[model samples]
Target: MLRDRLLQMLPEDDAAAESVEGLALTVTDLAPGDLGSWLADRAGQELGLDVAGRALQGGGDAWAVAIADESGTSVALDLATIDDADLEALGAWLADPAAPIAVHDAKTASHALHGRGLTLAGVAVDTLLAAYLCHPDQRTYDLGDLTVRYLQRELPTGVDAESDGMLDLGLDGDHSGARTAAARAVAVRELAEPLRTDLASRGATALMAQVELPVLATLVGMERAGIAADVAYVEGLAGEFDAAVERAALGAYEAIGHEVNLGSPKQLQEVLFVELDMPKTRRTKTGWTTDADALADLFARTEHPFLGNLLAHREAIRLRQTVEGLLKSVAPDGRIHTTFQQTVAATGRLSSTDPNLQNIPIRTAEGYRIREGFVVGEGYEGLLTADYSQIEMRIMAHLSRDEGLIDAFRSGEDLHRYVGSRVFHVEPAEVTSAMRAKIKAMSYGLAYGLSAFGLSKQLGISAGEAKGLMDDYFDRFGGVRDYLTGVVDEARGEGWTSTILGRRRYLPDLTSDNRQRREMAERMALNAPIQGSAADVVKVAMIGVTGELERRGLASRLLLQVHDELVLEVAPGEREEVTDLVRTQMGAAAALEVPLDVSVGFGRSWRDAGH
Candidate 1:
């Protein structure tokens, strides 16, 4: 067993070298951070350790085993079986501030250790973090899977082990945890080096080490502080939405001149196309389209009462689902603890699960009512939401270096109004609301490579007019057109596109023979950089905001991050300071030609703060 473990840990060297080579290493009894971890063992280099096993195996606050870097088997300690005095004596030398440790889930183990009244000095190499930095596209980074992929080593299949999420050491098998811990430590030590080197090569070391790792602690705190949900309020909102749904369905029935299944798509299709004899929409697999977009188009064209009520019904149903979801996910503490996933999106955007907070709507009046349920918790002063203003457009201006766009931003005038004036050759103040709306649609639409037909459909303008408007807008912001075209051209040549932070997205479809696929890929290629860069800036802003809050020794806590917006739970007597800190940190997060503007508001609820 010892020989095999040595061979696995020290792949380059033979078992004979291990027999002669050992460390005069000292380790303190494992302090904090022992949920699960791995140590990188350097024979003659600075000392490190790897740990794994139950967080509290055998009712103790320690790992099953603690192994020093490459010499896992030769100098492995069974921490679970060891006496307290022996562990403490063993720890005396390991307590050297210079010795660093590596961990998989940094917070899980670190928080666990902190709970157990133990702590480790020096940095811990995070294997999970390292893997993410090396290749963000990989879906899962499970330890067992990564051990096989990276090290080509399978975990030992022990007796009756790995059942119901617990690995069973033989009934009296005391050394199983130690063995698993030692092996994991060895695997992590092996994987950490190459990942670090890869991150450094790509200039992502600072992003991973400085930005991501440190933010892990703050993220853990935010998850723990989960935005308090007013259960009764959410329940009431659900009831209201349900009642609205019934009213909408009844109105649809009245509009259609008879009772029908509003939920039945086929019935709606028959009524829309056969009974009503409306204009035929695009075909689908089942029949002519009855989807929301098609229905919306029908409503726009015919001012159909049925279509309007159906749309309202659908919205009410969706809002009701959101309210019910929030109520279902409320924890014992009266909060909704969403799991924020860092690596879900290709663009480095964080995604929320377990009742997604990001999907909440705010465009409608009732939507605001739902948001009101996410009120300030007991003992918290109020909620403060700070959001980036026109972030993506700002990014587009910066990326394209369009003088017109940048000047519009710098002018401190209304952006849509300014763009409208240029497009219409009118004075900024003379730009009518209709003109500004068209320009606003085009400005945002163009960034995503929106077609004239799509723009016409969205703005209810003729295709010719939409195309002419786009031409006029681009005529003024030629830099933007050129930049957008250049992004696709470069991606076609290179087979991938990258964000400002060097986060790359591969686009092989750019060279595909299929024109549809190629065009879609081009749009993706254009949007990825702008959207991804904006995402990167927000991530940086989050790190900075959290760090700044920590630096100022404030009691305010960040509760939720919804894309461009962050909702902070302000402590009493600290609202003003928190608001300033939030704006300063977010504004300074990224350096662009145009400034990153932050708009902050505070109120008793998210809705008020959001306004």
Candidate 2:
């Protein structure tokens, strides 16, 4: 075991000599005693650690530790071969919050450790998150990329070192995995200084410490305690959706007066454009597009039954696929564990993947049934969902400080109805539903930087009408228009827009030479603060709610976070308590011009829990 572990941890002497020719570090395999010695040497100092694990959320297979001291040494420990005593000691050291350490993707590392019956703590810096804070515009924050970008060095590979002082350890297949892991640990160690410095310089240190890191831990808990699934229910829903797909497909074929592959875009195009003699939609390289929007537009113009049936077929197919995905994702423990991605969305919103519960439809009756597939487990009484109503609009009111918008919320009237009355020049009680709908659309659209033409397309109105409506809205709420313009202007000058919590989103393209790119960046700038602030508030609420759950000794646990909503599984007797706790914590998560209205519901399944 020792020999095998050594072979995994260190390269052969000749290979090491040739591989690290220009490198300044020594490589060593950590024997049992070396663990203590290296840790003792680095006590009261910052270090970097990485774990090679079975799965991202599974047990660790090996571990590496690198210190940034002048010694320039990194030690590798194979978890599989390490003595039981050493492993326990390692776990203790890991859980010690006093021991400062940095790692890439600390949540994954924490999950990996958790699978081994260990806990990970003391992660003072998650380089992945720090890099995200530094460069949120980037698509990825891979360790290799971070190492090259921040540390000005490439991670070691099996290839030999370049003569020009770049570090490379000529790792062979026998030891490449372990040696590479060690190299990443070293890179993470070296990255700490520049990354932390960048974060501090950006005034994002508190955002990282107070919001991101704690949310990381909270997410780890939520992912581990995945929501329970009704496997039988999901399987049944899949069948129903499949039937619906077939029925819609048949209906489409009958309407077209012939059978065609509903799944084929070419066939769809032939039927709609050539056979049915419908107007040509947007032209694509392959042909005219048969996408949902184009088809919907065609249907609106001609009221073609074929197009309607085609749209229904597409919807059924989508629902069926989602249900099938849910069925496949059911774990052996009879639950679906979704990975909440923190770094994906630039606005800091948490996204669900691996059978995304967040994407489950809510508005349509068929879509709502899919939520019924997620049920409370045997030990729980039911599911309780609490969500903030009109969170983004509320955020917009707070940020813009528009007196009309602010007063609209404070008046305890329907926001859209009140705004509609003002925009259409009617008394509040006399506002028509149609007028309120337009007001609601315009209000939310402004936050998204929606243009008049885009609003016209969405609401089936003329461009002139849409523009006039927007003019009226701005007239009534000039403060909002001014705030939006100022947000873009300030971002243009400063190269970044800031959230309520001082989280900056850099938009260098605000000064771009290209009109398209600059305008797009302007839209992003306008939306970032409102959307990002909502995300920040939700995160703060998650942290507070999770903390209070423990503080108050509640058995109900948070199952998932879907945008502005939180789903929790209530203990047999704890539904009322959990509801109160969630409402209080979530409503008080952030202070704004308007009260954060929380709607709570309880049900046996997720669908019924909707408020």
Top of the candidates by lDDT = 2
RMSD from true fold, candidate 1: 5.9
lDDT of 1 at 578: 90
TM-score of each: 0.82, 0.91
Compare the candidates by TM-score and give the number of the best one.
Answer: 2
Note the clash tally of each candidate. Answer: 17, 0
Error of 1 at 26 (Å): 21
lDDT of each: 0.73, 0.80
Question: Can you write out model 2's per-residue Cα lDDT over 1-611, one digit (the tens) per residue?
Answer: 33344444444564642342122222333445555555666788887876544333232443332333323445545555556666676677788998888887788778767766678777889999999998988979988799789877676655332222122222233444444555667777778889999999999999999999999999998888888889888888888888988898888888877899989999888888888888888889999999999988898899988888889999999999988998888777788889999998988788999868789888888888889988998888999998989999999899999999999999989999999999999999999888888888888999999999999988999999999999999999999999999999999999899999888888999999999999999999999999999999999999999999999998888889998999998998887788889999999999999999999999999988886
Ten residues in sequence with the least summed lDDT for candidate 2: 161-170
